[model samples]
Target: MTRTPEIAILGGGIGGLAAAAFLRRTGLPSTIYEQASELREIGAGLVMAPNVARLLRRLGVLEELAHHVVRLEIGWEFRRWQDGTVLSAENLAEACERLYGEHTYTARRSDLLAALRKSVPDDSVRLGKRCVAVIENGDRPALRFDDGEVAEADIVIGADGIHSVVRRVIADSIEATYSGLCAFRTLVPAEHAPEIARRNAHTLWLGPGHHLVHYPISAGKLINLVAIAPAGDYSVESWTARASIEEFLAEFDGWDPRLLDLIRAAETPGRWALLDRTPLRHWSRGPVTLLGDAAHPMFPFFGQGAAQAVEDAAVLAQCLAAQPDDPVNALQNYESLRIPRTTRLQEVSHGRSRINHLPDGPEQQARDKAFSDSDPLVDSAWIYEYDADTVPPFHIDTVAR
Candidate 1:
């Protein structure tokens, strides 16, 4: 009889935690190694689209997430910048449930992390163990940590973020190209926001070379905001850099009064350069594999970054559980199933950046008119309806080729 593979997950971010939790559910043990002293999320808010919410429900964290999220009913409302005119809208609750069997939601990043962490076994996560390298050792691979300790596992999952150290173990190098854009993120108290802004809604204010996205989070007590614009004279990639309120406000000068009010009301805003990698051709080799941003880093225009990572965890666990006798083939199956879909998503998101940031012109006018005439739900149905748990069985024949 073949032995079950001992799994090691690098990173404790959402992807790594979800991977560990799902693996445990399949009776496969996985240890998560996070570089941070404690497993905490530094980011702000993200949407859990119906596709992801359904998976979280299956992973047993939907109830916990529900406690922290504002269940969104009306999906997305695209608005023209100057007058806050409605450009288009998506029926998130009714259409989503009718087609996808679930509702969408937005939540604080910490809450999502906490929920996934709670689902994982306490002893399974080892914090502060930064992986510097992964080296081949016979059938198993050994991970070298920054603390001068080496550990070996039958399988190593690189769930680390875009600049993953484990990615070096698979490919020699990869460059994360910047989008020449940066985003300012902050949270606003519901009491502080204007009445119109306080509604339980997801709004996008689009303008020339800039856009603003804000929605309620933390059970509707606070509002999460992200202002994206061209990165001129600022190119740092870290997410914790502080930005002056004046600089943030300057980008939206002469725009809608309500939108400007929210920017001015922000107490402290953090800025990060948007960087992404082209979809990789391969995500696994031998006993090593990549997951989440490490596998496919995408632009945030689609708001599916975290959702895709969570989906990766579910599909990966399913593949491994279905093929315990062959970890190598199982890893290949996971890559094949994910690459095409994720690659298409990457392309679509990049296209949105151009569409959302277009200068006032014929092209921009046509795009807005199209949105006004049609529901975005129809355009995004495939993504909303995707159920990774119920995906067709991955064929090993393709992997054996």
Candidate 2:
């Protein structure tokens, strides 16, 4: 009989916590090591698309998340930047539930994190432990932290973000290429926002070299806004970085007056540079593997970052539980099933950056026409219908157990 392997997950973000929660469901508990002193997420908004909603339901946190989220009756509403002409809109409340068996929702990033954190045991998380290096020591890989604490585990999963320490252990270091774009993110009290901004819809205004997206979150009490434009000289890549409202408005100088009014109502907007990294061909080495942004970081055009991380957590837990003793093989299986899907998403998201920022011309007109004709829910069926809990293990029969 094989013994259950000891698992150590780095980073206490959504991916890490979700991994722990899923593993617990399989009767395997893991520890999460986070760099920060507390487990919390920055103030931001994320689309809880059907794909993620399905997985969150399995984890039993979707109900708790529902309390803090705004269920979008309409989503992906595209409009012309200059005149606010409606290009396309999706009836998400009806179509999303009927087709995908889940409703599309939006919520504050912190609320989502808190919901995931609640599913994980408090003792499973170790705060203020910044991992500096990962050392391979035969079957037991060890993590070396900045505080000089060394710990070993039968398997180590890197749930850390883009700058993952464990990722360097398995893959060659690759420099991230700047996408030459930065985003201004802000939240407005729903009472102060424009009527359109307060609507239960996800709206995007597309134009030359930039685009802005906004939707109501926090159960319609707050409006979250994100505007992507040329980076210029700004290169900071932090969620907490500050930008004045004047700077934020300058980026969308000639946009519709309603959007400008919404921007003017923003308080303490955060600006961060958008960076893209080349996707890795492999994410597993020995007993260590990468998950979430550590494995495949992409542009936020698809709003699928958090969703992909949750998918990674669910699939990783499934693979590990299927082969508790042979952790290396299980890690490889996790990579095989995840890397291809995530790579496709990465490429598609990068391509969307160009589509969303096309200058006014025949090409942009054609793009708008395509949007008007295609239904987003139908087009994204492949993504929304995936169930991580039931996805077949990659080449499970071929691997010797």
Candidate 3:
């Protein structure tokens, strides 16, 4: 007889859905609780790198995601905002295959969510059941919902987001800081976008204290544009699920005309206050643990947020499945294995702005020259090439769902 874990996952977002699917694959009985009544798409588009694409492929959903997303020919295409000068380019297709053994993708968040949701067991996810708190019972965890309903599971996994309630309840000590950057994100039809941005590439334009990244998502039909401005200038919270392009355009009053054009093209955009938390010293307590943004919320600069979460799900399942009788050790080992690595990524993401904030002048000119002449990607092998299931030192503890 196979030993399976009775699991409860909070949040029906990508992390929760992916966790449920992977758990099912491991013969573990699990269910996910979401505050919303329906699993709806949130946000504009996301760049799902190879590390994430490989995981989705493992779950038999990459091809499905591809049908709805645009596969980038290049991983990153850095340029100058003043004059669209190509500084450097990283070939993701070859790099992803060489490193992670899969293709990278950029797609609408809704489309990817749909693909993951398809893999979820029917009625396994209880929508609109807001999780109020998690009470630990040494080796078993019980969850209390906002609707006066309660549930128990052998293990409680918090796939909730940065403001995760379970993360606060179990490992209630991790501190989150508002990244002084508020990102205004939107998706525009390629026809509505500038002719120059219709290709399948991650295009970035660096300006003074601010930058913008644009890419073709949904097979080049929709152009996903993101503008990162210093939060000091804006006085509001992140995307509130409703914002107009007109609102986003005001921020670029003196920006490049081309950039302004692209921003104007995106009909309405959703925005978010970029919040990040240091990697927790402990991810699991007793029979409870945290996953994804709820555990270590990293900056979006490297685009590793979702990828890291997916890796966490896979690793957690592997650890628990290996030692059924000792789930605590399994959870402990998972936390030990994952914390150091994710902490490193979180630290790296903290200093990640330097590369993008390339100071202009002789130094920036030299930087651009070097990037243009030599492949910067040669140095990024450690990042884009990691496998989800392979137990690298960094992943001895972390897993994706």
Candidate 4:
């Protein structure tokens, strides 16, 4: 415990940067390797529930992102797709804050990345390094970059995302599968959005075989739209793929006209296949471990993808800090603490598709009635109250070889 080990984090996205920031908070310095030439994020919105809000505040990420965030008073509005009628709503700003001690907020992904990047040391992130494979280096694990550069660290954290090379090394070779859905995303300026869409709330329209979610971000100056439709067998999962506005419109042909106006206002939108991976029985092997999507990639139904990743970073940093002398044991303990929670989340996120995309029949009527009858905040309160900082640490005994 006298000297900190050299920690290397792969992938410079939200999970990677957050891992660096969290480790730095615990006096553990780490280097982040990003495949991109520069540190940047795709234009998108991210929602942070109270569970992650406390961690972000502790890590100083919330303070840095305060200027760019839209604090949500009304959390979620589940609406009917045909008439845009409210199915259920959760009042988060007041109720959730009172219960969980933190309010939910939404911000652009770029803003979050910017804040997390600032917390990390300026020289900690190495750009233009694409990790090809994990190589053995006598006693330490080495990373082989696509550009033929090799780097070794005392410990490696794979935050490389769903297509992670590190996952191939640690997991059971479980492949990511398409979820028979595609999402078209766009950011509409506040001026372009209709009055109904200008509300400071997150709205979700659920219907047969499709759903739409939009929320205010960029401090209420922009609205982020994500329209998901059944894609059947089409399986290209690139985030930068462009889809015609006509194609987007055709998918929601029968939805509310007001919602159509929001879609029409987008100049251009990007589309990507919705994909997920089966939860692994293990997420760590000795000093090498996986974080974020690299460990568990889930459908977006629960909106916990990034939140869970942030949670993982906090827990992993704490576990390592607790067992500074035996990092392999620390990683095993981390995996033990995280796998159950993340596995449940993956199952719940996948299960939501059945609930959100039901046909208008007896079952759909019963579901809508149930939604209208109960508050979403109370139903899913467990998700917002988890605090990774105070999670009971695992009892470490034997170290992994």
Candidate 5:
């Protein structure tokens, strides 16, 4: 690895852009081939956990991101659905920074994407170059796009996403399994939302067979609301699918009045079926590897989807820079370092759904009692305190090819 590898990344999403930004730090540049004609994120909100913020600080985009995010003073508040009885709340403002070395915040998905995009050079991203196929030729891999263009590179990284086109080259196609649940997401104007919803706290209302979460985003200009319930027969999984406000309200009938008021404040909401996939045992083959959702697609119960993607970008960059001369071994090293952690998160996230949606009974009572006694920030210390930049890489006996 005397000369820097010619890196090519498929997908211009957060993971892809972050990878390119991090690689640039090590004197490696990558070209991103995106399927979309324009670069934009879906209209939603995401939690900027400490693990993500620490990396953004290193990437030199934390100040830019701060402009669009609402720093949480209090968060992880869980309440009973009927009377809004407080179950548990964490004082994130004081504990988060003191314990994790970074503060927790929430932001619009588009704003976060924009902040990451600023770190990458404009010319490096080639939009509308939808990758249709990935071909492996000896040590070099080539990507075929929809517009009849073929590009080859010393390394190919698949940040494409869950239905990634590049993944077929490394492993067999695995269908995404539906979790028999659906989520309704909407952005309520802060002016119309209740005082409780406008606060800088992430709140969750748990009830029998359903749960709802809400928090302010876009610098407190809007409140992001997510309601999860049984899917019944509906099973569409697109992010842009629409559902009426009335339909969204019907799902939470007979709940607390304050919760109902918050629902009434929302406009047309997007509804999507929740899907899960088994973690891949291997994510590298030759000079190509997968990142983010392209490697492990999990339920969103833990709100770690975006955080994990940023972590993957950091670790991948570190591995490649450490093993400069051997790109193949670098890719394998990245896979080995990342798989075990992400797989554990995937399982834990999937298990949280059942805990949050238990039927009202002795089991539910036991869960509530447990929640009241536990501190969320302390419980998640392992996830928050991880610094991918400083982590040492470990080797396995063999990596599947």
Candidate 6:
């Protein structure tokens, strides 16, 4: 940009709020525009992985998140569906501290969003400002909000989300392929969740073409349940759509009774379609760019969706701080630095569910046996150890490409 870029971030989601907070650490004055009139969490719970908590600690919100969310100490448990047998055990607490110097956390989405919003200025975030399209130019990019208000900035970040306007402006029109699976999510009271299964660990029950995963959130007051099942049609996608509990548990009929109990505890879960997107060729155009789900929307299979967005915010801030005078170069550096890592993660998360939800048969047993030699901690080392505080020189070398 010709002048010192006045940063304007679009979206008030977790990533956008984190972006504002991370930018504050870099001494850059930025504003966030959100479509919602009020700042609140839309979803139920989010897994605050080690990398995410470590990044928050750098942003100075560790104590706050720990105060509201359950500090997950036990590792995750992966088990067989028909006959309950230990398929894999992950020592999450030890693995994270050893790799990234923090423990993984499971907290309500509202708590994390609230903490991040607290870190930024109240006036800096303008709610109810729906963004329509971004107009890119030589250096400055202008944003036209739906309310007929036009705003311009040296760098306009499209943190808006999966259906991002900035992304449409930068990359070609990529389609979101329905994964033929609908996820039912709800937050249950930890007290009501069968006492035997209400532990701090993330418990996974793998079945035929489906799975159930739940963990403690809201300081153990609430447990977040996510049930994934194959569907004939995923024509609708909404986070607040009402779901039928009876219909949802039908998929888990042959699975263990424990899985059914989790479903029963949920009052009325929301039906969300699993939409997958192809990796974009570029994430930036001139001084305008994309972040969070706008840049990369990974499947929830890896449990790194929010974590990756947080990583994006932190790294974007780092790049801008590293090159304050050159907004265009810094934005380009941000894309080059992140494209490979995010793209690889997106691909990895895209189709890994097949292993978890093996169709019950000899194939299922063989698949389970194959994972016996795999190490969850070691296999996911690349994802869990990712850091944004420091920038290595051409670590993946996408800039040279």
Q: How accurate is candidate 5 locally (lDDT)?
A: 0.90
Tens digits of per-residue lDDT for model 4 on 244-349? Answer: 8898899999899988999898758888898867789999887899999999988888789899999999999998888877788889889988999999999998
Question: Candidate 3 — which residues are off by over 4 angstroms?
Answer: 1-3, 93-95, 98-100, 233-247, 392-401
Each prediction's TM-score versus the true structure: 0.97, 0.97, 0.91, 0.97, 0.97, 0.95
Ranking by lDDT: 2, 5, 4, 1, 6, 3
Task: Give the runs in model 2 whose Cα sits over 4 Å from its true position.
Answer: 397-401
Best by lDDT: 2
Backbone collision count in every prediction? 0, 0, 19, 0, 1, 0
| TM-score, structure 1 vs. true | 0.97
What is the alpha-carbon lDDT of model 4 when measured against the actual structure? Answer: 0.87
Give the Cα error of residue 135 in candidate 4, in Å.
0.9
lDDT value for candidate 2? Answer: 0.90
* 10 residues in a row with least lDDT, candidate 6: 392-401
Off by over 4 Å in 5: 394-401
Better of 2 and 3 by TM-score: 2
Q: At residue 16, what lDDT does model 5 achieve? A: 90
Better of 3 and 4 by lDDT: 4
lDDT of each: 0.87, 0.90, 0.78, 0.87, 0.90, 0.81
- Native-structure RMSD, model 2: 1.5
Write down the RMSD of candidate 1 (Cα, Å).
1.3
Error of 3 at 113 (Å): 0.9
Count residue pairs with overlapping backbones in model 5: 1
